[model samples]
Target: MTIKPLVIALGLITGSVVLSACNSTNDNKTPITDTQNLAAQHSDAKPVVYQVFTRLFGNTNSNNIPWGTKEQNGVGKFADFTPKALSEIKAMGVSHVWYTGVLHHALVGDYTEYGIVLDDPDVVKGRAGSPYAVKDYYNVNPDLAVNPANRLAEFEALIARTHEAGMKVVIDIVPNHVARNYQSLSAPQGISDFGANDDTSVTYARDNNFYYVTGEDFSVPSSQDYQVLGGEPHPLADGQFTESPAKWTGNGARAAQPHIHDWYETVKVNYGVKPDGSYDFATLPAQYAQLDYRAHYAFWQDKKLPDSWYKFRDITYYWLDKGVDGFRYDMAEMVPVEFWSFLNASIKMKNPDAFLLAEVYNPTLYRAYIEQGKMDYLYDKVGLYDSLKALMQGKGTAQQVLDVHASVKDIAPHMLHFLENHDEQRIASPEFAGDANKGKPAMVVSHLLSQSPTLLYFAQSVGEDGSEMAGFGKPSRTSIFDYIGVPAHQAWMNQGKFDGALLSEEQKALRAYYQKLMNMASFSAIAQGELVSTPVTTRSGQSATNVIGFGRQSESQRLVVISNFDADAPQTVSVTLPAGWQGNAIDRLEQHGQVALNNNQLTVTLAPLASAVFELEN
Candidate 1:
């Protein structure tokens, strides 16, 4: 039932604020569901997210040559997401499976054998291609399917099986840009491609799908000492693409040939925002903040929208029909917030529980993006993730972490936390901590810090040192650009048994620790509890600067978490708990029974880079 815009305006004229149909938290209280309480016996856990780079997650090949082709290093397929693998992932305390790089992106692989159009090598990033450079919004990546013609069907089967394993699915939606060779062979009937209806003669237009450099041909930038596929000879790698009117680069570059530092593989999408940053779209009323998606949808029903906005709207609706539960929007801040309000509202009207996560980094715009854009969550990279990374690197202090919590306490639930992702340096890489065990304390803090969802990359559990320089550019982090198999993760895969039978004892122990912590975090208290910071001091009155402590409590339960961040020494730290909370502490991670908490305080010794979760007794 669509409410007319006229009726909405009349209602708005009478009432200053629209009411929310869903529960809007003061952003403080975290509520646990009965389902979570049932899982609490094993470990009261929050939402543990397992993010798999779809192309690389199931690859078991070990030939990690730089600039390797698919045949050389192997690619994971949708067929590899077997029922056994999904069950194992579910058993690892994962509530959601984020399938990254599922869409049809620009890649060097030939799919013409399946009648799919080929992307030009000059515009593609690497042999595997950048997932951000989307080529077709409506089709699944043929690289991920055993039979390229059945790509979408394979993905749909994966989605159904994921649900059968009691986990939700998340896929990326690269709304900010598309590859220079964007073409949608599988788009629904009557749907036009991006830039198909644009006025190419103008540099900027309110209705144009992209910003263009009028009367100019697109040229490859010569600034960087780079070549397509590291100068490997190919007929299509002749430093030429065929865009007659060159559009602006994805990263807002206005040059005919974008700088090497710019996002040259893709072209930016234009919302109604002009070059001067003036908006041409209708503004949402301030009263819309407290409104539910239905109200927001009703408010925008009769209004006219720009062509790009409608194109994206169609793209999202198409995915929703494919059994996708949510989207992790790429570079969402680049699109106008007004467009998001319309798009998200439309989506929520169709499926109100749809998860809408945005990659917005600017702290100042966080509130606006959540309230105005209706995003369910935003990456907490600039807050908790960055702080813990610095602390892990031994250049930051534990106090800075507390300061970060204080800064975002009001919006904590909406901040998604992670130590590693496709764009960030791996925790085991030299550029970062250079040790996978260092992630223990940081992961403890990230999961126990708030009621927010926690994310982990595929190999983070098994300690894949991200040193595979597989291609495209200088490599320190795991190569998302090239064909490479994560050695540690492949060991766990164990040639499709989906067991850690081949892992070293240390690797197996690391996986066990992750499972314990992640399952413990699933507890009701941690999932829905309020955080209270505890002072870290010892019985001898020595302040433990290398230790951090905090408590999570619900109406029925309480738990205290403490971690030692020092790299080489064990520390005995005393934590000052809240009044009236004294009990026998059971170590959730190490499984130590009955460490007493006397007189509102608990003192425990922790190994270097170790973390302990203490379940409090009455």
Candidate 2:
């Protein structure tokens, strides 16, 4: 199946495209056929991912104590994601559920009774710890299990439940690094721990799992503002997280004592890339660019690749065998692109339709990662997210949004659009737009403006403000490092009922709106259509500065979307349609009265920070 580029042209409109009325009584309405809706009918539905920080999602306890233990603050369990909870998520039009923090990571918790060593507070980020610092790649987090001995069974049950709810499962795979004390207790019979067989005396080796500093001992970073477990005393918080022959920091800091700001809790993985920025392994020829994952997989089958490559490949296959749908690779660009080519191809060979998403920020490396790395999607962060964020904050214009789309039009379909994720500030936070309602229009534009997968952070619909001062992570972004209850999400959770009975009227309305928007964006004609930038002008023929317009046309439907970014003022704008389009514009959103087209243009009146989706029909 050939995926076409989502076209975003400037001032160029195509020939007349006709669309039947959504509620037409006429017998001559055009019927959607399998050929016309092939993308939706033949392939997987355009994915709408709901990323839940698993440790925090089902925690009904609201005792958000700072640096508190799980006994004090409470941790969410895998059993908490009941059938009802998953049903509610599926009803929100989520095709995929990314369960974050499922793996066993280094944390300041005592689980010695369960055969897990107590993680030193000096190396752990918070009481719960950072999920990125993975300690055991082969085991699930014991804290999330009702029975620690059956943690893997609990995770497998969650996967089965997610699939039963009609949603695919996605989990994080931090390929660039692992916990400073990396160990794999549940590895297969023949498999060994990451650095168990390595020669620590060397700085770099083709087969070494980690890079070493030879003679230097690892030292804990020094900081005055930050303290181990917020200055509270603990046995392992004695200013020492022991390591002989110091390894490189996760972010490539080679110092024995990395800076306080560095990713000190994690250590970088070695992929046969030497110190002077040179590949020690075989590089794929330029001709491989046009080849498929099968060819890439075959290319590496005979080559002597690095041992780390095979380790990650084995890890991915382990999860795939357990029915995991795909992975969300963290910091994919930090590792060599060749490694991705090797890893992702192996994934495709196992599951041809696997959904491979990566966190790659560099625009220059986007094509290399997607085309060569065989990635299905990459974060559209630096481009679309940044532009939309600026527009939402009133520091950017509608043109900036259009311009960014134009810049990445060639790879737009592979670029996933998101407004909120774990790493980003919540739209309702004071540091952001300061109101949940402000995200409404921006979301419409972000979701509908491209033919890409859409991501919604958990509780984004109900307006999670991320304002809790939960231990190491402060306000503005939800704490991935602490155990805390999300107030807005908990209100919607309503004590595991999965119903919004306790939510405010405004939050309920916002959630309803999100449901409608997500459904339309995911399963409607907009999901697999060509996006054309529609020219917008005021009634007086001047460009509407704050209003952006675009058209999504599939064989089955034609839609004109107009959004007003102005927070305090309504705007009356005219949207120019294609030359031969003659129809009555029925407002799909808000259901204002039918808009009449005059001289190949449809005039719209939008409220402050409002959006309209006008479905045109004869």
Predicted structure 2: clash tally? 0
The per-prediction tally of clashing pairs is 7, 0
lDDT of 1 at 377: 79
Of candidate 1, the 10-residue stretch with the lowest lDDT total is 1-10
Over 191-295, each residue of candidate 1 has an lDDT whose tens digit, in order, gives: 999999898989888889898999999998774578788889888888888888999888778888987667888887888767766677788887676666677
Model 2 stretches astray by more than 4 angstroms: 1-44, 522-524
Pairs that collide, model 2: none
Clashing pairs in 1: 44-522, 44-523, 45-521, 45-522, 45-523, 46-521, 46-522
Shift in Å, residue 126, candidate 2: 1.1
Q: Lowest-scoring 10 consecutive residues by lDDT in candidate 2?
A: 1-10
TM-score of each: 0.93, 0.93
